[model samples]
Target chain A: MKTTQHKIPTARPSGQRPSGAVVKPVGARPVIGGASSDRVIEFRGVTKLYDGGDIGLDHATFGVEQGEFVFLVGHTGSGKSTIMRLLIKEVQASSGVVNVAGHDLAEIKRKKVPYYRRNIGVVWQDFKLLPNRTVYNNVAYALLVTGHSRKQIREKVPDILRLTGLSTKLHNYPDQLSGGEQQRVSIARAFVNHPPLLLCDEPTGNLDPETSIGIMQLLYRINKTGTTVVVATHDHAMVDKMRRRVIELSAGRIIRDEAAGLYSRDESTREFAVRMRGARLGQPEDS
Target chain B: MRFTFFFREALRSLKRNAMPSFAAMVTVLVTILVLGVFIPIVQATTGAADEIRGKLLIDVYLRTDAKPADVARVRTLLADKTPNVKSVQFVSKEAAYAREKARFPDQYELLGKTNPLPDTFRVTPINPDKISEIRNSLLPVAGGGTVAVDPAIEEVKNRRDQTAKILEATNFIKITMALLASLLALASVLLIANTIRLSLFARRREIEVMKLVGATDSFIRWPFIIEAIIVGGLGALMAISLLAVGKVAILDPFAETFALIAAPETLNFGLLIAILLAAAIGVSAAGSTLSLRRFLRV
Candidate 1:
């Protein structure tokens, strides 16, 4: 049900170094794909070995290009949220590198974390709406943080609310709205700044089936605006319905990565496992 | 940055974290209360001590047959020997007896016409601290075991026991008062820091939301700063009112009970108000910043 998005905020985790990562040469970044500079999210052998010897992620490497809509479908604890956490700098990679929007996440200083995070919008299973604030103020809060003028915030908040289908509920508090409507306010808040990347962790996990489809459609429409959207979900039916690029994870490793694939692939194709490393040039070679 | 937004959010935050806010406010109330009371007491104590020091005197009784020239020479001698003696006055035998008779009329009546009291020299020191040195210089010193005496002097009394007791008591009062004020102020700071931590803990959810929304550290800090001010200011204002009520009700009614030996100069009412207002804003700002820097991380 509701999973990974709830996990990302147990942040600043104690991560021991994963035992078996190849140390790269100094001044040389491991370019997973030869032309990987344009990728909005890049992970090169990233691992997160949490405290108490539990591995959250292990030696995962992949890249998501600009304007791409991707889904990270995994059961709970399959490291779906770990990848998102790495991108958002919520947790440091125990080994290897995670680069988002052309900046190595670990290199961002502690004080500057707020500035770095503002450029990326993040929503989770919990609507995480300020219950006391009205929907308009909640959405306007995102724009306010980035130093938008009151008038500029006035212009932008309503537009984002309309896009999220929350224009009529602007003055309604979170408790006054339905589950899906509350989620929409959070999404509007996340996207109000038009961040370069939008991350959603089980955005529709708590909603009913029909409401979920509507929320998915809102995210689909937002992705059309050239903002890269990454959704981490355990909802097999929704993943199968969308049929977008899916990164499948099981037990902290990327087991299969498929372009426009269903939630699960046949076990018989195990030997033809899709390679995640050098994509965007062509299709699968099974190597 | 909107005022209405600030007020609205501040009210909600105060409600959400009521315990911590109350604890912080109570701590502020008590701190300002200590400040309001401590300064005046300390000032009053120091003033009383100064008054007591000014009244201390040394008495040197002279040989009754000693000439006025001998008394004058003795005065010059004391002035030269001890830089501490501020002034010296001679009381003639008749005058000494008259003053004594005024104090103990029954004893003087029994003695009839025979005046047994000696002519005396009363010496005042520049300060209480110099009483012993000036007294010693007025009499003869012993080089050997033999106690040599000044020829013009009959007996010398410096009121050494009385002087020692008063100096010790006043000094003790001043030192204890200073120590207590300092310790209370220090305790207040520590209490403020601790209560702020509790307040920040209750604020964790808001902080997490702000951080996720990509608020600048200052932006995230703004709402908390506002809450602390509102709460801390309320506490301080209540303390001021309590003090005003206390001045009229307790201190005024029982003025004699708490009266010092001498109620010396004290903290003016206007100064106390100014200090309390400044402390309210300043301490709340500091308390929030101190706790927020550590506990505000998402």
Candidate 2:
């Protein structure tokens, strides 16, 4: 008999609780406290200003819990990309602290950046795949950069390609593949290392609606596993269809933070829930 | 494993960027070859000067009327008193006449009738500088018996001194040339390093991508350094080959044309090895240093 240990909420005793409390605390919701395996990214009053004297990020403080999916929605130049760059240590903040996966960004040594980044994966809007390399090599490159052995690379690359729905296009170059397939290859590269955190910056920006929904479903499936996902994009339709926690930014400031919310502002022109459901159904459940 | 990965990458990059690597190699080769030529010339000049000083000898002539006892006394005196006198050979009057006749076969007919020449004692000095010492030691012992030092030995000493001075001037020129060659070689390394750095800069996005995926600094830098080393090594090899061929085909014949200076023979195996090693090491050091600078910075 495999009995699950349910953590009991250790708040004020039921008898000592205040009278007018309408919300019942569900057994602490397994807070997932910083265990050795837990991965959490936190920003404490992080601010970034460009050398040209424009504020890129403004005193943003937030934390993404382990195994959670969150959307970072903002207009152009609204500091969404800035926050992503700070997490990767690609850009330094003007002030305040940034801690990603237990590594402090402020005092992180330059030599450790590669190691720091290895714990996280990144996908770009343009797919950022090497045009010269084949689909198989493109995905394998991530492992290669980490100095993985050839045997591991040979074993892991095919598995990742299969996971990304790119198993059949292994020999094709970026130019030979469709835009969606290229983006899938890029996604495969990001996930090949099995990084705990995956940051996607406008991954579906160039994709058509059908392909965009497919890409979103792929991300959704990946999020279901244990990886924390932070998606920075202006694609309101995809955000609305996912119906996840949305942190909306406006002019370097967080204006809205909604739990299990859909895109409700002016940018919410297209509804993708129906297409997203269809795409989700298209993939085999076991995969 | 790390080094192997980097080396592979470096070889791949070199293949991809063939033109720039080739240019860098040629630049290094030319500089090394020029330096190679100058090194031997400098060594040979110094060697020739030393050889000339060692070979110069002074001869003391005896008067025709001098007694055989006086001649024997002079020989014994030179052997005992002069530290500079390496050896003393007493030339009998008959032997002296025969030597004069050998020098001028046509003049020997007149020499038989006139008896113009005198017997001589050839004093071979341990060094050219000791020629004067031997002359001074013998002058008084001759007792105004017409003791004449061979003018040719004096001429040899003057010529040797002049040759040493000329060699000094040439050595100065060689030093300057060597310095210039070194500077040129350094410039070539810098150019190659900068060119590779610029190429890396252009592919910074690729580097960023690699970095994001956990590429170590060693992994990233190894390829660049290997590429630089390959370029430098190939350049040095080409330069040495050129030097070897030039030394044999060109410099050897030129040396033969002026065989009296002994320049060609002075360029021996030991000197060639020194020049080749210097060039190879110089180019390799320059390339490796430049490449390591960037990696060490991070």
Candidate 3:
């Protein structure tokens, strides 16, 4: 396995972290539990069948503990995107319960969906950056809609940008940045409010392999700050290399769930060997 | 969000999408300007019709050879307390001749010597529709019908055709103005709505992004609302100012052409301006809000 890089891009010159900064000791967040608590995400027999008789998710059941990083691996149309939408309450489950950040999604009022979404950050494969706004304003937009004061926005935007290694490109528009840089800007915007749960749907889907590693490392450092992270991707090489908690799906069903699991049943070691050989010989890689 | 933020954003978008915004504003301006000019014209026409209707009256003439007592009885009958009679004015033969000379001096001079006009009573009715009733009561009855003239009465000239013409003209004016008012109102509403829909449709992507970033419906709605209001309000102000200029430059100078009605100064411009501004703001806001409903569902 390739050695994982644990580097934070740069440290602050002042040596004192800002309030609500994610540089605190690990496990500082308490793992609360009982018959009903400590689960950041819970889906019990959740079935989502869209109109026209297509099944989005078929009786999927899983739970993520606080601060856990879970990899959701599947091919295209494997219900990965549906899970992200369901988590954000963008699509309602056809049956069973979906709970996110201690709120039952089924009971959430339509009027309250915006407020509910503020507690959870979401990143998409396309980056979803506003082309009209600069990198700073794109991050500031998250706070702008939530009624944060200008003073608060001014104080928070720069810190988040610096944290996301985007301080130099603050005034640059989305089109002016690289694909990976645009993804980083979206991440900055997502994490600006310090949402406790961050959900990413194929964050590195459009980036090169080298840039993809950088993004994965960034997500890893964020997860270390006690923010629960769930990433849905089809990148088997990255999955096999990282070997984190994996949840595999096929045909809208959860086929396997394991701590430190690979991307698939038996293709882990062979996929890793092929990818490492391709990287060493500077050959074109395939997923 | 801060009010300044919303206001700034609105101004920014208005500037950014200058073409569509200008189109919307111009549409609003034309609508309000048309309304501002015509509404008063309609009101003035209705008022003039009312004035003309009030002046309609019937004239009752008496025979020159009628007895003094008969004349006195006819006068008493004409002046009887009736629900429809508003007032009675008596005119002697000499007075009637003088009125004739005044009205047609050339015709009177050709007649040159003997006074041929008869004494007359001009009767005004409370309701113009009751003119026939007054005429029937004043005319003398024949053996079989009331067509034969009484010895005391020379003629009962009600001028029914002239009254009918006036009434017909007034009704025609009313119907024409009402149709014109409704057509103009509908045109203005449609123009404003179409312009607003285009402006909002051009920026649908921005709204989708806002919604995805967790903006409540109000936050998503307010900037566009403010933008629409600015467009509407600016349009109304421009229209009113243009109308005022037009009145001063054109309508006031050609006052004789519209002599049947009150002057332009008496048109209650302040009220028209207030109403125009309200409508501009109202219709544009409603248009934008309704147009945005489908897009905000993202």
* Top DockQ prediction, candidate number: 1
Candidate 3 chain A: worst 10 consecutive residues by lDDT?
Answer: A5-14
Query: Tens digits of per-residue lDDT for model 3 on A104-167?
Result: 7999998998998888888889998877778998999999988888999999999988877888
Candidate 2 docks at the CAPRI level of acceptable
All candidates' TM-scores?
0.75, 0.67, 0.75
| Clashing residue pairs in candidate 2 (N, C-alpha, C atoms within 3 angstroms) | none
Error in Å for residue B46 of model 1 = 6.7
Model 1, B1-298: lDDT tens per residue? Answer: 5666667768877886677788888888988887777777777787777778778988878777888887777777766666688888878889989989999999999999998877787888897876887656655466753231468877778788898999898889878988987897778777776777787877677678888777777777777888888877888898899888878877777667765622635547778788877877677878888889875666
DockQ, model 1, C-alpha based: 0.45
Query: Mind giving the per-residue lDDT tens digits that candidate 1 earns over A1-287?
Result: 21122112122222221221111111224435432456788777778998898888987766687877789999999999888888878788999778887788888997898899888998889889987678998888888778788899999999999887787998988999999999999899889888989999889889997677667777776777889999999998777656567778887887755554233332222122221211242543322
- List the pairs of residues colliding in candidate 3: none
Ranking by DockQ: 1, 3, 2
Instruction: Tell me how each candidate scores on DockQ against the true complex.
Output: 0.45, 0.38, 0.44
Pairwise DockQ winner, candidates 1 and 3: 1
Candidate 1 error regions (>4 Å): A1-35, A261-287, B1-158, B167-195, B253-262
Cα lDDT computed for each candidate against the true fold: 0.76, 0.68, 0.79
Worst 10-residue stretch by lDDT in candidate 2 chain B? B150-159
After superposition, the stretches of candidate 3 with alpha carbons farther than 4 Å from their true spots are A1-35, A261-287, B37-162, B257-266
Clashes of each: 0, 0, 0
Residue B171 alpha-carbon offset, candidate 3, angstroms: 2.9
The TM-score between candidate 2 and the true structure equals 0.67
